[model samples]
Target: MTISPLETLQRVFGYESFRGDQQAIIEHVVQGGDALVLMPTGGGKSLCYQIPALVRPGTGIVISPLIALMQDQVDALLELGVRAAYLNSSQDWRTSRDVEQAFLAGELDLLYVAPERLLTDRCLDLLSQGRVSLFAIDEAHCVSQWGHDFRPEYLGLSLLHERWPHVPRLALTATATSATRREIADRLELNGAPHFVASFDRPNIRYRIIEKNEVRRQLLSFIKAEHEGDCGIVYCLSRARVEETAEFLCENGIPALPYHAGLGAAVRSANQARFLREEGVVMVATIAFGMGVNKPDVRFVAHIDLPKSVEGYYQETGRAGRDGQPATAWLAYGLQDVVQQRRMINESPGDDAFRRRLGAQLDAMLGLCETVNCRRQRLLAYFDQEIAPCGNCDTCLEPPQAWDGTVAAQKILSAVYRLWRERGQRFGAGHLIDILRGKPTDRVKQYEHENLTVYGIGADLSEQAWRGVLRQLLAQSLLAVDHEGYGTLALTDSSRDVLKGERTLMFRREPEKKARSTRSASARGKDAGIVLPPDAQQRFENLRVWRSEVARGHGVPAYVIFHDATLREIAMNPPASMDDLGGISGVGVRKLEAYGEEILRCVRE
Candidate 1:
C-alpha cells in the first residue's frame, strides 16, 4: 500500500497540514518534478522535501554542507521513526561502511552526504548500483560565489542532473537575493524547475538597533532585563572576542559557552552538544556557529559588530524565534564599524567589480542601521518585498526624530577638506571630529588645525551628535575613509553637493529620555503580546523542565522532543487524555503514541 505525502506527514511527523507552499512542492516532487525552493529559515522548508523523500521509492539523497546540520537532521528523522543516516568525515571507516551497506540494502529512507563526499568515486559507485529516489540540495545559495556561504563543491552539483536526468531534484535555501537565486539555478542546472519563493519576513522577531556606548554593559542589561534565562546566541566578529564575551557572561552568572573555528574540533563538538541539550545556555560565537543549529527556542540573536552584508545579517538574525514565538534581533553599531568594514573591503583580494558588489552590500546594511523608518519594512525591502511598518521594532514603537543637518553637514565637510586638501594631512575621525567640535587636543594643536575656520564650528552639537552626523555622512556617500591613509576622512565626489549647500542632510536624533523609558518598561514586561497568566506561566516552565529531561534521555535536541509552541498549547489547555493531547497542532500519531500519556500526566499535575 502506498502512503500519500499528507498521510506520511501526519503519521511520521506531527503536523496535520502543510504550511505555505509545502503541500504543493511535496506533490510536485513526489510526482517526479524538479523544484527550486526559496523559503524562510523557520518556514518548514525541510518538510517540503522530507515528506516527498519518504513517500517516493528508494532512498532520498540530501546534499548538505555542514556536518552539524546533517547530524541534526538525521537525529530528528530518527526520532520521527524515519530511517536516516549521514556520510561525513566525522564517522569511522567501519561505521561508514555499515551505513553504505544499509543504503544499498534499501534499509534507509533518507541518506545525507556532503557535496565533497557525494562527488567521490566510491559514493558514486554505491549510488549507481542502488535505487535513488531523488536529490535534495540544502543551502543552495552556497553554490554562488557572491553568496556569503559559498562552497566550491556546490559548483559541481550540475553533474547530478547531467548524470541522473530521470531523477527529480530540489534545491533549497533560506536566504537568497534575486541575483543569488538565478546563479544557484544556473549553476545547479535547475533552470526550468518551478521556483517556490516564500515571503522572507520573520515577523515574530523584534528588530532593534542601539548605538554603542558600553558594549558589555548594554548586552548584560538587555539580557537581565528582557531575556533572562533564555537560550540565545551572541555573535562576535573575532574568535578572541567570542571567548572573552563567553567568559564575561559566565562570570556575570549567565551560563554561557564559546564556539568558534579556532577551537579544537572536539571542544567545538562538545560546546554545540551542550547548547543543544541544555536549557537557557547562551552561546557566544563567531559567524561559524548557528547555521545548521535546529534549535527552535532560540529567543534572541545579538550582534556585537556590524555584519559584512545585509543578506548575512538577515540570515543570522532569522535564526531567532524559529518557533514563531516572540524573539529579539539586537545589534550595536557605530562609526568604527563603518570604518573597519571599509578598510577590509579595500584590502580584499578582489577585482574592481568584485569589490564594488561587496561594497554595495555593505552600503545596504549601513542603510538599514541608519534608517529612521520601520526596521522590518526596510529589511524586507532589501529582498524586494514591500511590507507595512511592523510596530514591533524599536523605530516603529518609538519613532525617532529626524532633524535637518545641512549646516552641521557643511561644517563637517569643511573640516575634512581643510584637513586633507589644504593641509595635505589625512587624519581619522577622532581628529576631524575634534576639529569640527573645536576641541583643541594635542593632535589639533600639533597639526595647527586649531587655526582652521571649521574648527569648533560644530560646538553647538554634542560629541555623540557629531559622531552620528559623520556616520550618516559615510552611509550617504558624502564622506569616505581613505583606506590607504589609515582610515583618514576623505571627501567623495558627493561631498561637493553637501559642501555646496545643494544637498540637505537629515539625521535621526538620539533616542530621547521618554522613548528610552518607554522601551525599558516594554522590555521589562516579558512576552508582552503573548503574555500568559500566572498559572500558564508556571506550567510553561514545568513543561520546559519535562522537555529538557526527555530530550536528554533520548539524546536529541529539546525541540525535537517537542517545540515550545506545542508545550505552550499543552500548558494552556492542560489536555485531559491521550485523545485530547493528540488533537494538538504539532502532535502527530507517532508522537501521540510515544508521549501522549506522559504529556497528559504533566499537564494534569
Candidate 2:
C-alpha cells in the first residue's frame, strides 16, 4: 500500500502540514521532477526530501557535506522508525558492508553519503545496483567557489544526474545569494530544475552588534545576565582566540569547551558530543564547528570577532533559535577587526580578482556593522530579499544617532594626504590620530607631525570617537590600508571628494554603554523566553530531566529523542492517556509505540 505525502508526514514525522514550499517541492520530487530549494536553517528543508523518499518507491540518496553529523541524522530518523543509514569513512568495514547490503536489499528508506565518498567509483557501482528514489544534495551552496562553505567535492555532483537520468535530484541550501544560487544550478546541472527561494529571515533571532570594549567582560556579562545555563556557541577568528575564550569562560564559571582543527579528532568529537547531549555546554570554536549541528535548543551564537562576509555571518547566526525560541546573535566589532581583515586580504595568496572578491565581501559586512538603518533589512537585502525594518534588531530597538562627519572625514583624509605628500611617509591609525588631535606624543614629536595642516582639528572628539571616524572612513573607501603589512592608513581616490567638500558624510555615533540594571538582568534570566504557568514550567523541567536520562541511555542527543518544543507541548496539554499523547504533533506512530506510555506516566507524575 502506497502512502500519500501528507499521510507520511503525519504518520512518520508527526507533522500536520507542510511549511512554505515544502509541499510543492516534495510533490515535484515525488513525481520524478528535479528542484533547487533555498530555505532558511529552521525552515524544514530536510522534510522536503525526506517525505518524498518515504512516499516514493525506492530509497533516497542524500549527498551531504557533513560526514561528522551523519550518525546523528540517522539516529534521529531511526527514532522516528524510518529505515535510514549512512555510508561514510567513520564506519568499519563490516558496518559499511552491512549498510551496503541493506541498501541493495531495499531495506533502507534514506541513505546519506559524503560527496567525497559518493564520487568514488565503488560507491557509484553500489548505488547503481540499488533502486534510487531521488538524489538530495544538501548544502548545495558548497558548489559555488565564492560561497563561504565551499566544498570542492561538490563540483563533481553534476554526475549524479548524468549517471541516473531517471532519478529526480533536489539540491538544497540554507544560505546563498542570487549569484551563488545561479552558480549552484550551473555547477550541479540543475538549471532545468525549478528554483524555490524561501524568505531568509529568521525572526526568532534578535541581532545585536556591540562595540568591542573589554569584549571578554562584555561576553561574560551577556551570558550571565541573559543566557545563563543555556546552550550557546562563541565563534573566534583564530584557534588561539578560541582556546583563550574557552578558558576565560571556564574560569569565570561558565562551562565552555574549545573546538578547532588544532585539537585531536577524538577531542573534537567528544566536545561536539557533549555539546549536543549535555545542557548548557557552550562550545567556543572557530569556523571549523557548526556546519551540520542538529542541536535545536541553542539559545545564542556569539561572535567575539568579526566574520569575513555577510553570508558567513548570517549562516553562523542562523544556527541560533532553530527551535523557534527567542535567541540572541551578538557580535563585538571594532577598528582593529577592520584593520586585521584588511591586512589579511592584502596579504592573501589569491590573485587580484580573488582579492577584490574578498574585499567586496568584507565591505558588505562592514556596511552591515556600521549601518544606522535596520540590521535585518540590510542583511536580507544582501541576498536580494527586501522587507520593512524589523523591530527585533538592535538598530530598531534603539535607533543609533547619525551625525554629520564631513569635516571629520576631510580632516582624516587631509591628515593621510599631508603625511604622504610632505614627508613621503605613511603612519598607522594611532600616529595619525595623535597628529589630528595635536597630541605631542613621542612619535608625533619624532616625526614633527604636529606641523601638519590638519593638526588639532579633531581635538573636539574623544579618542574613541576619532577612531570611529577613521573606521567609517575606511569602510566608505575614503581611506585604505597599506599592503606593506605596517597597518598604515592611506587615502583612496574617493578621498579627494571628501577633502574638497563635494561629498557629505554621516556617521553612526556609538551610544554610551549604560550599566545593566539589576532588576532587568534578573528579569531577562528568569524565563529566557520560555513563558509558562508555574505547574507547566515544573512539568517541562521534569520532562527535560527524563529526556536527558533517556538520551544518555540511547547514546543520542536529547533532541533526537524529542525536541523541547514537543516536550513543551506535551507539558502544556498534559496528555492523560496513550491515545492523547499520540495525538500530539511530534508523536509519530513508532515513537508512540516506543515511549507513549512512559510519556503518559511522566505527565501524570
Candidate 3:
C-alpha cells in the first residue's frame, strides 16, 4: 500500500538515482532524523530536501531567506511535475490564498517560506493543522553573525525546532567557516544533529591576485587578452564604483551590466536574468547580488575591490566554473582598500563585538591577498582545513621573481629625499619614478630636477619592476601614500631599515614560464574531431536511464552507484557479465551488489 522512496523519486522526479550523499541524507530524514548539508554550488543541495519531502508522509516545509530563491526552486519543482508552491512577498493576494487552499486540501508536497515571514498567524495555523515531514533551511550560513554574510532573520529560524520538535530538519549552506559552523548549530537549535561536510575547496577555479595599479589598463588587458567572451562578475565596494566600472568596461567594448542595491528591482532582475541566459555578459555588482544565482557556466569572477572576508570571496568565486570546466578567480588590491575598510570600521556605530570579528576576518582576507605561499594552501589553511601546495593557482603555475633591492631601495629613498629638497614631498610613485628615470615631463622641468644627481640613477630597471618595488615598499610599511593628497608618496619609520639595508625586498618573478599551456591541441583546431562516439552516447543515455530508474526507485543519485566514467565504460563495452561491471572503477562492492542485476537487465534490454 505504501510507495518506497525510490519509486517516488522515479515516478515523480523522472530520475532513477541520487547524486553523492543525497540518498543517505534522504534516508536519514525519511527515518525522522535531523540533517545538515554543506554542498558546493552545483552539487545539488536542493534535491537532498526535495526528494525526502516527496517521500515522507507529510508536507515538507522549506525555510528559505530569499523570496526570489524560493520562486526559482518552486518553478524548477513544478517543471518536474512536483506539487510544490511558495509563500512569499512576491506572490499576489489571490496566489497566496490559492497556496493556502492547496495546503488545506493536502495538494502541495513542498512549501517554501521565508524565515522572516514564517511566524505569522496564518502560516502557523496552516502548519499546526498538518504533520510536517521535514524543515529544510536553505542558505543556513546566514544564521551566524560571525559569518561574512549574516542575516538576523536566519537567527530567528531556530523557533522551528520549538514549534515542531518532532519534525525532521535539514540545514543547508554552500559556505561556512568553523566559527560560523558552531554558531549555526547553536542558533538553529540543532540539538546535536549530525553534520555532512563536503570539501570546501573548489579545484576547478584558478585563483590569481594582481597588484592594483593602472587599474583600467590592467582590467582591460585581462579582459581582452585572457577572458574575452566569458561571463564574469566584477565586485566593487560601493554602488558608485559598480556603476562607474560597469560603464567603463562597456565603453571599452565589454558587454557589462551593473547590479547593486541602488538599481531598481525590475532592472536588476532583468540584468541578472539576461546574464544567466546570455553567454559572455559581464555583471558588475556589490556584495548584495550573486546569492542564489544559479548560473553554472560563469567563466570568471574578478574582484576590482577587496571582499569583506575570505568566505565571501570563496562563495562569490565559487559561483564560476560550477559546470566543472576550468574557470578563474581574479582579484586586484592596493593599500587604499585596506585604509578605506579600516576607516569604515572605525566609524561604524554597529555592535563592538560584530566590528571586532569583522575586522579580524578582514585581516585574514588581506593576508590571503598578500601571501607568498601557494594561494590554495593559504586559503584552505584559513578554514582550518589542509591541502598540499595546489599547483593550480597563478603563483604555483608562474611565480613572480624578486631582487635584493638593498641598493635600489637606497636609490628610491634618495630620490624621494632629493625631490623633497627641491619640490617638497608632494608627488606619487610616478613623479618619483619620472625623476629617477630623468624623464623630461614639464613638472620635472619646472622642478628643475633634470640635473639632479639621483636622476637616471634607477633607469637600469624596467617600469614594471620599478612599480613592483614601490608596491612592495608600500606593503613593507617603508613608504606610504598620503590619501588626502591623492596618494603622494611619503617615507615611513621603516624606511630607515631600507636605508641601512636592514631589510632586503623579495618579490615574485614576472610571468615565469609556466606549465599552463592555453593554446593546446584542444584549443586549436588540431583536435577538431567528431563530437561523441554514437555507440558511447547511446550507451551513456541508457545507463543514465537505468541508473535514474534505480535511483528513483531506491531514492538516490544515479552517479552514486557508478560515476559517468563508469557508466561510459559500461556503455562502451556493453559489459557481458558481473565481472565486467566490477572491473570498472567506482563500481565498488556495495554498488555491485545493489544494482548489478538492474544494470545487466538494462544492458540486455
RMSD of each: 2.0, 1.5, 7.3
Which digits, one per residue and each the tens of the lDDT, describe model 1 over residues 216-308? 878887788678888889999999989999999999999999999999999999999998888789999999888868888788899999999
After superposition, the stretches of candidate 3 with alpha carbons farther than 4 Å from their true spots are: 1-17, 350-356, 402-505, 512-605
Candidate 3 C-alpha error for residue 288, in Å: 1.2
Candidate 1 deviates by what RMSD? 2.0
Model 2, 1-605: lDDT tens digits are 99999999999988888888899999999999999999998889999999999999889999988767788889999999999999998889999999999999999999999999999999999999999999999989889999898888999999988999999999999999999989999998988989999999998899999888789999999888788888999999999999999999999999999999999989998999999988889999998799878888888999999999999999999889888878889999988889889999999997999999999999999999999999999999999999999999889988999999998888888888888898899988988888888899998888777777888988998889988998888887788899999999898888888889899999999776767544232124423566888899888988888888998999999999999899989989999888788789899999999988888888888
User: By the lDDT metric, which is better: model 2 or model 3?
Assistant: 2
> After best superposition, candidate 3 residue 117: deviation in angstroms?
1.4
TM-score of 1: 0.96
Q: What would you estimate as the lDDT of candidate 1?
A: 0.87
- The number of the candidate with the highest TM-score is 2
Model 3 deviation from the true structure expressed as Cα RMSD, one decimal place = 7.3
lDDT per residue for candidate 3 within 1-605, as digits (tens), equals 75677766655544557777778888888899998888878777888888888888778999887766776667656545678999988779999999888887888889999877787777888888876788999889888877877888787778888888899889999888777777898899885888887777788788999778767667767766667777788888889989999999999999999999888988987887677555579999998888877655577788988888888998888888765656778898875666456556656667888777767877788768766778999987877789898888867876655446778778888787766766565677777888777788998888777888988888888776777677666555567556463656767787878777787766544464334334221112111111347877676778877766764554333333344556766777787788777666445444566667888888777
Give the Cα-based TM-score of candidate 3 against the true structure: 0.75
